[model samples]
Target: MAFASGSRADRPNIVLVVADDQGWGDVGYQGHPVLKTPHLDEAARSGLRFERFYAQAPVCSPTRATLLTGRHPNRMGVFTWGYPIRPQEITLAKLLREAGYATGHFGKWHLGSVYRASPVHPGRMGFERWVSSPNFFDNNPIFSDEGTAVPFQGESSVVTVQVALEWIRKQAEAGRPFFAMICFGSPHAPHQAAEEDRALYLDQPPALREFYGEITGIDRAFGMLRQALAELGIRENTILWYTSDNGALPKVGSTGGFRGNKGQIYEGGLLVPTFLEWPAKIRTPRVTRVRCCSADIFPTILEIVGIEPPANLPLDGISLVPVIEGKWERRPVPLGFWHYPAPGISTPSAKWMAELLAAQQKGEDLPPDGPSQRAGQLPDPPYPSDQFPGHAAWIEGDWKLHRIETAKGKIRWELYNLEEDPAESTDRAAEEPERLGAMQKRLEAWLRSVVQSLNGADYAGLGESPSLPESKSR
Candidate 1:
């Protein structure tokens, strides 16, 4: 029981609802052509809608790492698809637990290899009770609860809501200030829905038919989630944060008017919908246009709880508490982003990623080194880390610079002033050489700093003060 027992005056339960592969246009507020999300829309209507909010990465594990650790996924060792979040990193759950919030992770836990001995398993990663899956589970899929894989009935979204509801109820009964993360793997892939959710979109266009069904199912589950919170009399006090893992994935929902699908560094890949609903705190539904990211979640929670990080390990995210309270206009600091090392497995999951994760990390102390320690493993050559051309981007005011390494010239860079080109349709790199070069230098310097921390070069210094991208006066 790592969760400390704090005084009642110092605690508030946190419920972070993450929808997998859910797009900006999938919600009712965002105006999907046919999707029905009455509950989520109401959450948006009654809470603060964060426009220009982004997932830390273009994928789930990376984004989750950001939300939990208040830093880039690379800094925590979750670089790409199927990479496990290294155990040494700090997570929101761990922080909240230290601050006396009982933490539980319900739904998908994709930050690690789901195997029983993975170091980064949910239980080992600071969660008190974790009912999770290795990754996105199709309908009626198996879930690893703490250690055992159990079959769950009903749709994926519905089951996720139910598990979370049960956990919250238990925590409430125990009089504990709980921090539960419901990482719903809905709308991710293998888009399937119950007949009820399916019928709503059956008459729509071929492209939206199945996709809408998936979102609807997720919506219904969201409704149930809200109802459960209200029924428990905790809806008003709980901080309910809703957002997605990444932007709209390909062959699925719309990314609103943004260009490029998931996997690209465009706004579509990074920018997803976001909102914070706390009826007691955010009584009015205010639309905030400030830019924020998944990394902010952890630090904000710590700030709200008044648990100042040790003098050594400062946080990367600024507290949005003042913003939520309508006390500020713009973030006083700059935001950072790096889609680094590239899109490949960056961890030690050699060959057992599939079966091992399903079993969950059962043993105590769960072995530290996963696939990496296995000889003849370590993944083959052309690792995304080595071959994948990565782009380190920085958005200051209206400008975003992406220094890419394409054959177009080894040191290619593209600049997009989002104020003028929200869709990022045109590449003005060659046109504005001077401005591009300046921004590229800034981006490169930031990349170097990120790489230093990501490779564990500055863990000791991190506790003293989290690294920041060198400030540039745009």
Candidate 2:
């Protein structure tokens, strides 16, 4: 049967649940023997599981920025972790809000400060309500409740889902459509799990035991969320998207035999497990091999709600609605990724940002990174350079091209047919000379466009004043 096709009210409610560092093979459905993820496994079996989905970038903040804005993270100068997104850039929440959908955010919000006064906080980003952490947190986290830090009980994922469900229930009771972004901080570093969850992996090594337990905790929490949706009777018309922000961590996470781990531009770093469940639209369960990215979320949601982006805006993502309906087989537009060379800001822990938010409420004066003010800064290059001085890649169909910058300031190019080399072991650059040359030109042009955006081209005529913070590179 065809998916629902009707008025705007028939449109599905969208929920995006992102994991911090869950790997491509971390779930039970992906053949992980140690980790217990029955809820995610069931979702994969009952939905459209993306076999070749990728995160826009191989990190937390940048990928999250892409998920909301449907633009490359670098466009708004969010090149690394803890970098803030530009306030002027349009966000998915704002777009959906204008379309008459209520929006809320829960869990880890590493994109910027959770403090209410920050220009790029979740509230300013279009989420009407939010309970977010500045970064990753463990059990019993202190969350910024719409800009005020408050203590929450329970494991991280469980706490996040509970708050989200509360907001969702409120919307459903009021007969209003809603969008909820649930970002989990599980399976990241400093793995912490409830005693019961950890007990499931006690036989394993100490480190692996804790890591697997955290994932199990996330699985249980997700199952609770799915149940809530069904009981609320919104499951039939809700679009639920689940995936990680990036690839796996070293030693603890699995990349499913792909090359490289987190922080690289390789398949392992970029590729992540993704599943979408829309009971009203996707009547049958299936797996799709089409390449998709986190950036595609914005356009996909827009297509579902029959909303068009502002004219003259350049979106890096194309709508995947056709792909979902099984009409479009191949990706129409090439995807680009660049890891700009820089180190992300390192805080002592989640408490640092929580304290900052608390300080802001007191109306005290503090430095940008201190308790009173918690704004992150983006880079302002001396001049827009012609050189693409970083590791970058462009994927078109099964062909993947890579440009790596060496420490000695040298550039190297590598090409691979991903269909024949999922591991990216063989460099076909020598044999496919003409094809490689064409891809290089396309990549260079794409990089040039991104540079233009970094310099504030997309915000033309938005009338919002720009906030250019002081630049600091590590």
Candidate 3:
């Protein structure tokens, strides 16, 4: 095992819960007028709440990719939704499993097709056990049970949590340290909630009833999971982390008065609610305005386990351990975001994925790349920086710089003082020349580093090349 074995107390259990498309104002603690997120609100009050936490990307797949690898999504070619993470990139599950931790993933697994034999399937991606759906699913959805379609009962969020709780209980009974990631599909699309949950929003507008109810269901499920930890007598030592994948979804979603919505590089699109509860480590519950991103999660885990990351891999995020211990205040490094203007490759439908799994179970000959193999097929090597096009940004303290390339091939620069104008209402590109120049230089340099990783530079001496022939085409 990679992690040096130690006392049971030295290896803390970790639970990471992610909500799909939930926003900063989705929880009642953030002062949302209609949404009832009691469980999340309680979490914020009893934990270290992050006032300025950000998702690495403004989309699901990209932020998720970063959460596992500690590198920017674009580096691994996960540009947008409907894309699979390149198999070469390291994942948190794999890391934890190697460290003698029981790891399981439950709920939505949008990183790749859940079909059997797919190289990027949750199991192949390092998850020891996974009960997952191909993408966002509604109530009573059919899940890929370790690559076989199985019907599940009850609300989407509730079912996901129940599945995760079952695995957690077994690990707890075995006295084994474990890592569980519960990715809820509720409040994503086709916003569907149970009839009882929808009844709570009867006074809400008919159009928003389902959406609000979905959030409530998520809150209920979250509350159940937390309560389970307490009942299992494993609440204090376990680190429970909660956050959304990205920002709000425009009108129906609330961004807490920031500018832009999902898919945009604006503050509203990237910033999301975040909280970390480790009763054994953090005794005081307080909120901090220090800027942090999803990329930091992987490094933070390594720090908690007292393990060093592989030297060859480059991480874009720093550990938040100091912050948790109240030894750090300001973030030493600025956060960078680049939404490469690239369309994500589409995977096969759920039906086709199920059919492929059945063929595998019957000993049928299938393609080596498995089902959904046609989604991504990379070209020959020599991938250069110029080929990676995108609108990039760099956030240093309060200052933010945006670089946009128009369809006409014209470059435009815009700067914003986020501390003064959190909404990004004013552009200070012309007013602040020196600051703009410095930020632009930093942004470009960061992009160059990311490009090198995209070209398989980071994996050079790691024994495995980063090239993904049937993936990473993003």
Candidate 4:
């Protein structure tokens, strides 16, 4: 099904489909027993499948920040989930629109809802027409369509795709070249799926069955998305990307035998499923073993769409357009990982998270809030730059280092040669002190650079929440 021939000069439409909480092996090609991802499977067979792509962070907002800016999330001040994208950043839709493309984003937009009474919504973020939710939602959800929160019925996954389909059809009829981002929130938390979707995998255990059912529900809609594109004659030229926000939620599906699940700096936590389909440009069906991260996406898309990147802006990710075009050149830049010094609760921590969720389900509810959703500039941190310390990591070549700081002590260190051991099973700090020492110095240097970036050394404090035409936050 791969497109036999074509070129970027043809100005193909683009569709970036992102799945929330989907694991590494939660599909047919990855060898999951219950999950059935026919559309994604066929897309993989029809295009380039990246076997070792990673999210920019182990959590959501940070990785998404990377997606929009082509820079490390931490560098842009998105150190955790639900953080704002620093309104000053450059986005793909905005850049692509410079080329006469009609840009839109439909589905989950966990970036920032309303900040500083500003109109920095999707349209301000470079998207022309946006029907988005602040974050993940269940069936019969209420979401913001451009500004108004509207109610929609159906399973969350199906509803997510259905909304995007409607938008795509409109764009097609207008003969506009489009770039759409479809964010699906499924198999995350309080698992919900339609009875028919659940029945599709009723043979499995309760948890596994529910997990698989949610995935299958999304899979069917993904197939429909492809079909709709083909019927519109846009499938062949579109560079359709399919990937997850992060890794699995554990037990639901394997993180492909990597160390940790989601919400950790470990390979398993950050690694995710990634594939690119373009019937026009991609010739042979292929698989990439090279490591790629979410930050690289921005630069790659800009290059593909012929936008000249700012030379003054330092980007941690190189353009991946060459790699996607069957070229063989590895990215030479450093890949950064910062889990922040703050200890936030992430999922799959035994029954602790489950218990919190269960209690809320029982109606003893705790209101959810985060910094990004809070209106205005808000307050800055009380601690100095040095006080924060959960964990920080840096990956250069095949070497990886993890730094752990105690409440009142010098930070401890651990190192691993990922080339020799990808799973990071053994800490070679004690065994090979010199290699460890060298990596520690490099990691520190990278950290200093990160600190500089965070302080706005790059853009000089230019990006901030724009004043919205109307305050959506009440």
lDDT of 3 by residue, 183-236 (tens): 999688778879988999999887689999999999999999999999999998
Task: Look at candidate 2 and tell me the lDDT of residue 365.
Answer: 33
Model 1: lDDT equals 0.71
Question: lDDT of candidate 2 vs native?
Answer: 0.83
Write the residue-wise lDDT of candidate 2 on 362-450 in tens digits. 97533334421433333355336477777999999999999987756688999999999999999999999999999999998999899
Candidate 1 displacement at residue 284 in angstroms: 1.6
Winning candidate number (TM-score): 2
Alpha carbon lDDT at 50, candidate 4:
90
Across 1-474, the per-residue lDDT of candidate 4 in tens digits comes to 222223444676889888888767777888766577787788888899998788878877677777877887777677776666665667777677666677777777777662122334576777777777666666676656665445688887788778888878887877777888888777676677777888987788888777777888888888888899999888887889988888878767578778888888788898888899887778789998777888788887777767787555677777887787767655576677777754432322223223334544575532223444342342254224454366777777777888876768469888888778888998988987887787777777777777766766676554543322321111
Regions of model 3 farther than 4 Å from truth: 1-5, 347-381, 465-474
Question: lDDT values of the candidates?
Answer: 0.71, 0.83, 0.82, 0.72
Q: Model 2: what TM-score?
A: 0.93
Query: Which TM-score value belongs to model 1?
Result: 0.86
TM-score for each predicted model, relative to the true structure: 0.86, 0.93, 0.92, 0.86
lDDT of 1 by residue, 1-474 (tens): 011224664366888989988767668788776678888888898899998887888777788877887877766556766667655566677666766677888888777654455556677677878877877776776776665556788888899888878778887877778888998777876677777888887777765666677788888888898888888888877888999999897867688988867777788888887898887768778998777888788777877776765343335577787778777666666566766545465432222333444435453223434442231122233133232246657777777777666634375667787879999878888898888777766666666555555555545554522222221111
What are the C-alpha RMSDs, in order, of all predicted structures? Answer: 7.2, 4.6, 4.4, 6.1
